[model samples]
Target: MKLNKAFTLIFLSFYSFSKLLAQTDETYLFPINPGNKNYLAGTMGELRSSHFHAGIDIKTGGQEGLPVYATKRGYISRIKVSTSGYGNALYMLHPDGNTSVYAHLREFSDEIAKYVRAAQYENKTYEIELFPDPYEFAFQRGDVIAKSGNTGGSTGPHLHFEIRDEQQRVLNPLHYGFDEIKDNIAPIAQRLAVRPININSRVENRFDRKDYYLSRYGVNYAINDTITAFGKIGIELLGHDKLDGAANQNGISTIEVFVNDEKYHSQIIDVMSFSLMRDIIVHYPYDIKVNKGRTYHNLYVDNGNRLNFYESKANNGYLNIEADSTYHIEIKMYDPYGNISTVTLNIKGKAPAKQIKERIDFELDRISYQVEKNILKVFTRENCEEDANKELSIYINDSIKTVLPAYFLNNVAVYLWDLHEGIPTSVLSCNKGVNISINARAIPHQATVINAENFIVNFPQSALYDTIYVSTAYEVRTQDSLEVFSIEPVTVPLKSSFYVSASPQFSHYQKDKTHVYQTDDAGNFSFVGGSWSGETIQFNHRSMGEFTLVTDDTPPVIRPATEKNYYYISDNLSGIASYTASLNGEWIMMRYEPKLRLVWIEWPEGMQNKRGNFELKVKDNAGNETIYTTKL
Candidate 1:
């Protein structure tokens, strides 16, 4: 690799910043920079695929081997190295009852590196974790602990740093006064949303949520439209934050909502618990995130959201608008530096019309239903003029469980069922039968077991944040050329995990080649390793989706090293399980990063043999292996 002059200058500046940190006396020095403006690639509370980001990411100028320093006098309490998730991480326990963490490291300091290698060799595994004695690997403030690199789940070269309280709650690193960082820019409001709480509620005279555009001028934002809403309504927002010297967007520090000059909602993301991190799914608009790829922080508490960071004065962060009343709405966002951006809008309440809506037109025999936030809304076609007040029946295992009166929405008869009571097997209305499709009800705070014809699922008591209406169907064939057990409504996600056991639908699949797979919307397969007991294979999974049982006899592909730096690249359809590298029939260390599908040699004890026989062995998750050999 080569670097332009500008890139070379930035690389030099990164090293200079590290050298400056080595002399700093600050109580909590920036891990990679001190006495200068520290750039960030990401911030605490940023939204991730599964949870909120636990820490801040310090930029390393697109280069590796930047020295990472200890922010406080502490001992290395824990160290971990793995192919995924914060590869090469170090945790230090300080005297002040707080823990500091540095992740995505290239290598530890000299003594720590030696210790990690000896333990890895002794354990005969590249990935390992160690808890040292209380006083081992102790260091003073500003002492180098490791060098930053792109490892683990990192997308680029940066250092992931964090601070945690004694209870393991992730605290915002910016809460500790670090002069190495400076930000004066206010967060920018991306979009504003208002939700109609119920059927009686309306936003802009429509019984649905509405999104409004925002305009900004420095620290102020405005919604140009005067929103017309009635009954109960709530607000949400999407936004990003900026720092002075970095061209990166980050998470806002705080979000507050005000109605009629009184504070209605407030949430400050200063600390987070890993145990409760999945509450992010409910804290934000999950549907909007899944559909639009935008994370909108709710200005009101959502159902099943159990986070403790929200504070409000009254009415649980909702506005009750009466007829002919005007309410001024304001949303304020704050960055860690106290920079403020205020968004303002106005709402006027109006009474709904008493006249019946225009008759809707739809196919007379169509019926469908989906669950949202534990409410099952069933839509069925109905006659427009002749007796629209029909009763819909709910059935459980071929028995009539209950009946619900019809409500008309868009000329369609609708039935609503609160799933907390129980899940129904099917719904009947207007001479049409709508199967609920769910196999069982997995409720929170209790273990649920379901043994169906094709598969058996064991739902742990902790597997659900709320009730899940479980549904599954078997398909004999699909594009994957395998037997599929489709789990309907993959839209609803589980906070924890559940175990699923199933016997192979086909007898031809051998136990060795047979593995369970979770399929995506596009029909791609991700290997879910399973253990067999007789003919049943069981696996633990955190998601509800289409599962397939098939034989994978393909081996991983090993790409030749494109660089002269002894790099080896490899990939597999079922995912790489493990790999090993040896030179001259002697074991040597190989660093593997799965994200890039690359593995590189790390010589032991500084061995520099000019000529040798080298072999790399790679294995796929399905037990297929590939070997590559070369003479150097």
Candidate 2:
């Protein structure tokens, strides 16, 4: 039996590779319509908040229930259903050692749907993941597999599709033979930015970087003038792509930078691994933090970025210009269809300008902290030109903890503390009330606990990626009837989710209506559900920010958008969680678009003109439910 199993595995691997070669020779059909027009809403390697988008988003004409077909002969390998992220997703493992994913689906085909429903009932949960045997389900190319819909984290109706190799690396779907889809439009360059990378460097006689709006000139964009710079400098481009008929702006496919007509850096978005997705932030970290709705590509690669998309970087794409000279810079942007756009600029290298150091005033609001390795690095905007050689005191629990000498890097004052020494208790404060309370074990590899008057925080050894000093505090807003707990600062990124248990002052009657919420920098609260245990509420969060206990008693409101049947649904406090609509006693399919706050059901075929009693039920995250009944 063991010998037979090994022989079977070898045969399957060989068969899969053979199928892969055949498909590469243009034997497979498009996953959707083969002859109809198809547009892409997003592309592989698109930069997202913390990760790169690993697949393509195919437009579904802003509607749901579009038939999704199998791209090749494959077996149903995996199926996942969830309320968030890729709801109702299906994965197919082809004989070619590749897997095709269909996400945000409305429903599967009849046979697959039956299987899924039975599994859901057996598991007794709406969210589920299942892996079926290879012989359980199989399909040929062009077989209808599922129907696309707007589900999960989707902002609109589109099909999120992916093609992955046997090792699970996502490959650009466009690389496959989808020759019928047409895109002749080129990417557009909007702006260019130049930054002084070194402390001795200056851009246009200023220490800070400058952004220049680019205007179209013939086939290329130009800054229209030369930029004066000294020492090492880096560049950034703001650009996006557009398909022939789609109005949605998509990510560019490739970028190449040249200096003096020589290739300095290039990035081709054809493949990506799941582990390298987080490096999207490092590629354009500043832009990712500040820009919303725009795509910014950094011409330079950071020293720590490990993404494989970048290639042939000369000094990581930074131009070192110490002497008087002139250098020509050119950038080429491309779309998946081979359409290209070019931009050109000139950098005039000159002598460094006179340096006049100014003293920086340390403000309480400007102080922040970062954790790198085992060092707790404190950053302040205040220039410490004179204080660089001076020692500053760090207080823990209102007592003098230790004194560390300040250091200056690029005009900013920074202080570093080694966590291997010891972990402080209660509060960590420097001068001017810049303090935060932290649990000792909050840093990874360390064990610590924190107990305050109203909250208790427990940190596991794996909760952090590095050693960090954490600060927390509690506040009561009597006027707003809120109990706020300042967890950790937002600048610190958490590697693993942490637990927080807080005892907020609330009445027993508010138990069902009360839940924990995370607040943004603007003081706006978003629901973060918690479990109530006696008087304490416990929750786990992946981000550091302010949290509060909020009571939401109002039920969700459902308003009819169309006089015939459509309804506009909304919630005043906690967002909508679950909704259902039924005719008589049978449940009917209701298409919900949370972004548009619209919900409606298609008139059932053969019963389009039938009139009956309709009941709609909507529930919020806080357990508030509202029901509406009316004659259709």
Using Cα atoms with residue i matched to residue i, what is each candidate's TM-score against the true structure? 0.86, 0.71
Error of 1 at 403 (Å): 7.8
lDDT of 2 by residue, 338-359 (tens): 8999999999997754432544
Give candidate 2's whole-model lDDT: 0.75
Instruction: Point to the candidate with the largest lDDT.
Output: 1
Pick out the ten consecutive residues of candidate 2 with the lowest summed lDDT: 424-433
lDDT of each: 0.80, 0.75
Candidate 2 wrong stretches, greater than 4 Å: 1-26, 196-201, 230-233, 286-288, 291-294, 303-306, 312-326, 349-481, 487-513, 521-523, 531-538, 553-571, 576-620, 623-632
On the 0 to 100 scale, the lDDT of residue 108 in model 1 is: 96
Report backbone clashes per prediction.
0, 6
Instruction: Report the alpha-carbon TM-score of model 1 versus the true structure.
Output: 0.86
Candidate 1 residue-wise lDDT, 305-372, digit = tens: 78998997877787888889998988888888889989999998987543235443444446787666
